[model samples]
Target: MFRFFIIAAEIIILIIVLRSSFVQYLFEDIQNSVSDWLVSVATLPEREELRSLKDKINIRLSPLKPYQQNYVEQITADSASVKRFYHTYCENDDINPNFTGTKRAQLCLIIKQSPVMQVAKRD
Candidate 1:
């Protein structure tokens, strides 16, 4: 009976710890880190265009200041939308077709992650 009580107490403590805000924050940080890693890996530059694309994306994303995170899920859902936007905004401005496949994929991700980019307009 004593061992049972001890085990029950440990379980209760474990549950409390799991429910704590610190645990929540830890999980959020882990998720963010994983997400960042995925984005970095997917965006790795194989060609020259990708090397400078991040800067260009930041500049484009800047105008949509006071950004919100609510749209990220919706925006990221449709890759075609991102492609159209990239072609319309990024590719047309450039004078060449030097952009690589990886670069284009990364551009789509960058815009999708942007808080202020309109997802509705794409649809």
Candidate 2:
């Protein structure tokens, strides 16, 4: 009986591990597809607004000293306005509407990692 229970537990653990891996792969595939779609859709005029906002923010804030620029970048990158714009326009509405603090932090990280922003800062 104990051996049977141990075997059952091992099988359950294996199933859990496989299920998690599958979920991870599924999510990654969906993300990649959405990213491709977003890039294509971003060529449209409506999406141009987001790009323009980024440009404007970069222009408005780039002239500051390095530390000030970092401060402004951090603030603008994580601001509610940016989050709203991304959620309202960039993301699919079918997903969760609530942008949690972690999601906002991820947005900030993306902004900070953007090569376009880096180039803009240089010029």
Candidate 3:
């Protein structure tokens, strides 16, 4: 019917118009706005007052004098216990690992240990 033909022709024209550069620009602008909103939402809250003194203490021990090493170890042990508490309660291995007193345990908190990194290295 003529009415159907008119409706179909109008829809086709609308589609063609939407495919034009101006409509593409509008679409891209909307996309950029949405992504910017997501970025704002995904950002972590600004760290509270830089960092606490415990976080200031380096977990590494060798370079320090024995007294400093003892102090660092005590602080590290306390922080490690905190890590263990969260790991136990949350039951998320990815959040933190079993914190042994090794250097690797300290580094594990700062680095990505996911198997994906291993795959990337292989390639």
lDDT of each structure?
Answer: 0.53, 0.55, 0.48
The CA lDDT at 32 in model 1 is 100
Worst 10 residues of 2 by lDDT: 92-101
Q: Write the per-residue lDDT of candidate 3 for residues 1-123, one digit (tens) a residue.
A: 999999999999999999999999999999999999887666422112112323443433234456654544443343344345335423354432223345434434432232322333466
User: RMSD of model 3, in Å?
Assistant: 13.2
lDDT of 2 by residue, 14-59 (tens): 8898689788899899999999999778656434544554565456
Q: In model 1, what are the clashing residue pairs, if there are any?
A: none
**Candidate 3 accuracy as lDDT:** 0.48
Indicate the residue-level lDDT of 42 in model 2.
Answer: 68
Please give the range of 10 consecutive residues that has the lowest summed lDDT in model 1. 65-74
Q: Which pairs clash inside model 3?
A: none
Give TM-scores for every candidate, taking all chains together and pairing residue i with residue i: 0.39, 0.26, 0.38
Best TM-score among the predictions, by candidate number: 1
In model 3, what is the error at residue 1, expressed in angstroms?
0.9
